[model samples]
Target: MKDRRRFSRVPFKTEVEVLFERRRLAAKNLKDISLKGLYVVAPERPPVGEICQVKVKLTGAEPPVELIFTGEVVRHGPDGFAIVVTETDLESFAHLRKLLSYNLADPEKIEAELGRLIR
Candidate 1:
């Protein structure tokens, strides 16, 4: 069972198509993602603490999100390797959070803004 707080792992597996340092390749069946880091199930394990950029597409969202950040390899397994994202492009992450049912202070804020615009 994965924890649901702090470093909350996503429910479904994802696909991380990566472009790293002039090299373009795709990893299959990404496991989980969180604010702290993401776990990628990859066969070709990069060296531990090696920083690499990754692009992951969340399920049910149009246009795959591009993540240009550094990741360090933490562990390697027979089926895949686990990577810890060192840095993240939070700008995109924030936007995605909004799309994924993020709570707004007031749901009618948008309507209030629109009302002001009309007046």
Candidate 2:
């Protein structure tokens, strides 16, 4: 199948908490995150199209930071589920950029993508 992703994915692995249907699920992640969304592997998967909250714990920040996104479940498969990000707070957005910038080969490319994202 053709990849429809607009943003480049960064290989990131960490513990992520998925909140859906008023229940919080702990996921041991094999995560690949982008500016747009993330892939999460959890035992209990949220249904497609379900609106949920995802909190990705950034393990090594000075104090600590959780990159939180309010997103929709867009796909489900054996690997787990894919969430398409709808919204995030300003701090989370900033941290997300930093994380992606650190991981991706061309930091400026992501910044360029961010500019395109606005329109």
Which candidate gets the maximum lDDT versus the true structure? 2
Error of 1 at 109 (Å): 24
Report the error of model 1 at residue 47, Å.
1.6
TM-score, candidate 1, is 0.62
**Top candidate when judged by TM-score against the true structure:** 2
Estimate every model's Cα lDDT from 0 to 1.
0.59, 0.91
Which digits, one per residue and each the tens of the lDDT, describe model 2 over residues 6-118? 79999999989999999998898947999999999876789999999999998897787899999999999787999999999999999999999999999998998898788
What's the distance in Å from true for residue 34, model 1?
1.1
